[model samples]
Target: MKKITSALVALGLGVALSASVQATSNDEAVAERIKAVGSVCIEGDDTCGGAAAAPAAASGPRSGADVYTAKCASCHAVGVAGAPKFGTSEWTDRAGKGMETLLANAINGINAMPPKGLCADCSDEELQASIQHMIDSAQ
Candidate 1:
């Protein structure tokens, strides 16, 4: 009877130890699975990676029609939110406000239009060009 009891006690200890080892392995596997796959380094953070590369040189300022089509057409094409409709009298009337005022509105933003009209990278000359393109489209 004592021998049987000792055997059962040893079996229980073996099972418990095996279960503990299995649980530890499972935890390690879960951690491996959940670890971040990649990391991000902000543009100037040397500690994260290395010195940020300089921005590529631009070919030059894009043409007025190209800038207008890419950036301005979304709203101006149909006069969304009161933007002057392209190729319509609305642009003509806004043109009467003069280029100075128009450029101000474009750069500084007006009403529903955000500054630079969603073209954050566009230079002042580019913005002026786009404005002129729209003005020229006036019918």
Candidate 2:
């Protein structure tokens, strides 16, 4: 009976040791996986330090004539969509509406004319200069 009791105790200890060893190996495996997967991405990583900043504006504003010749002429010169032909009496009626009205119409669009006449990125002031070019041509 004494020998049987000793054998039982030794068996229980071995079982406990084996369970502890399995638990420790599981913990080690989890730790190894975390080390492999986790990372700290800083300045040099995939985000690449945010978007690049836009360049500064030009020293002075672009000229009205330049803006018109490049953008307005596409529609206005040929009277596309009933747009008054450049330098025609057709512009006289629109000119009669005054410069402020013309600038607003050019920037926001009116009748068959598109906003900025499809120059979407044009600033309100740039559209104003463009209107001035058409108005100047009519004179």
Candidate 3:
């Protein structure tokens, strides 16, 4: 009877320890699942805890041909929706409007062409460069 009692106590203690370990593991799993996926840190906020994230590198303003190829080619390539076709007299005719008027038209949406001609990120100088590129192509 003494031996039987000792065995029962040991078994009960083992079961309780196993349950405690399992509960801790389960709690950890739950915590991991509920953790935040991402966090935003404003510049100079300092409260973000760790080191500040590095700013994105600047590659400088894109060339006219590069901007035109990426943004303007879609509509301008084939003159879709009345867009002036590249390498045509259409650009020459439009050139008569002068740089100021053309720049304004390009900056503001003109007819079917949207503002910046699909280049929302293009600066005024870059736009002028692209305009010159197309005009040059006409020759």
Candidate 4:
């Protein structure tokens, strides 16, 4: 009877150990399956994926009309937040400040406007052109 009881105890211990090992293996497999499959590539890095290269600038700076429509129209079109409306007298005072000051204000942001008019990626030339587009439209 004593030997039989000892055998039963050993068998129970073996089963528990086997179950614990199996659970650990399953947890590791699940973690491996859920791991991130891709990584971010910093600009200028050479090892990034082929399609991840920075977009080439267009053959020329984007047209002011294009830039304005894409970036400034939302605010300037309807004078949202006091933005000067295009094709109207609302910009006369701002235009009176001269193109230099207008460009500077648009680039650096003034009042409720954001720097570069919220077009962070716009080049200085592009911003200038966009401002000119607004001025032209207003006049």
Candidate 5:
């Protein structure tokens, strides 16, 4: 059994050395044998959906009203799914819940509200700005 193990190890080492020796040839022939199977695409390419271009143009955080229009307006603007319409009596009542409470709820989420309105990328400062925007508009 010991002899068999030694033989197997020697054979493995021989095969490895042979492979490295063969790979040492810096000829274009080896490269020609291997074809490029794929490639990367840049932004504006039809396949990428132009999403990559969007981030480069992301251009700092949007204003509260802008973020609200782009993300929060879907539910908050119209109170869909019981989101509490912006600048309505319901919103005023919610504001009465206290700013800290509202900020926490908005950032961490409240019933049916989903954390950060499902905008996981939104910064806390941005969330606070949106909340303040809501409060300011309500008042």
Candidate 6:
């Protein structure tokens, strides 16, 4: 009877320890799930949630000519999807509409043009410069 009692007590202690470990592991998993999964960082805005540190800046803003050739030329060079061809009547009308309108359209996208002309990495200033470059070349 004494031996049996000792064995039962040892088994109960082992079970309690196992259960405590499992509960701790479960709590850690729940904490991980409740943590933020991602974050957003907008240019010129300092209100991004503190999910991550800011990325290092690139060398610098790419030149307008380089940006146009690399990004805008695909559509604008040949007037794909109604994109104004550089140095033509189409761009003349667009240029007459004013730079602000053009910049806004380029940044936000207009008609079939994707936002930022699908130049996901280009900044607003770079896009504006590219637009100006196209307008200058077309004239």
Indicate which candidate wins on lDDT: 1
Candidate 1 lowest-lDDT run of ten: 49-58
Specify the highest-TM-score model's number. Answer: 3
Question: Model 2 over residues 1-139: C-alpha lDDT tens digits?
Answer: 9999999999999999999999999999999887855444465555643343323556466677777888889988989989988888777778899988888888778989887888876777777887877776774
TM-score to native of every candidate shown? 0.58, 0.54, 0.58, 0.57, 0.54, 0.57
Tens-place lDDT per residue, model 6, 14-128, is 9999999999999999999998877666765667644355666668889999999999999989989888998787877888989999999999988899999999999999999
Query: Which window of 10 residues has the lowest lDDT sum in candidate 5?
Result: 49-58
Candidate 2: worst-modelled 10 consecutive residues by lDDT: 48-57
lDDT of 3: 0.90
lDDT of 4 by residue, 6-39 (tens): 9999999999999999999999999999989988
For candidate 3, what is the TM-score? 0.58
Select the stronger candidate by lDDT from 3 and 5. 3
Report lDDT (CA) for all predictions: 0.91, 0.80, 0.90, 0.89, 0.80, 0.89
Badly placed stretches (over 4 Å) of model 3 are: 1-58
Clash counts per candidate, in order, are 0, 0, 0, 0, 0, 1
Candidate 3: tens digits of C-alpha lDDT, residues 1-116 = 99999999999999999999999999999999999998888777777835447665668788889988999989999999999999999999999999899999999979998999
Off by over 4 Å in 4: 1-58
Off by over 4 Å in 1: 1-58
Q: What is the lDDT of residue 12 in candidate 2?
A: 96
Q: Candidate 6 local accuracy as lDDT?
A: 0.89
CA RMSD of all predictions: 8.4, 9.2, 6.9, 7.8, 11.1, 9.2
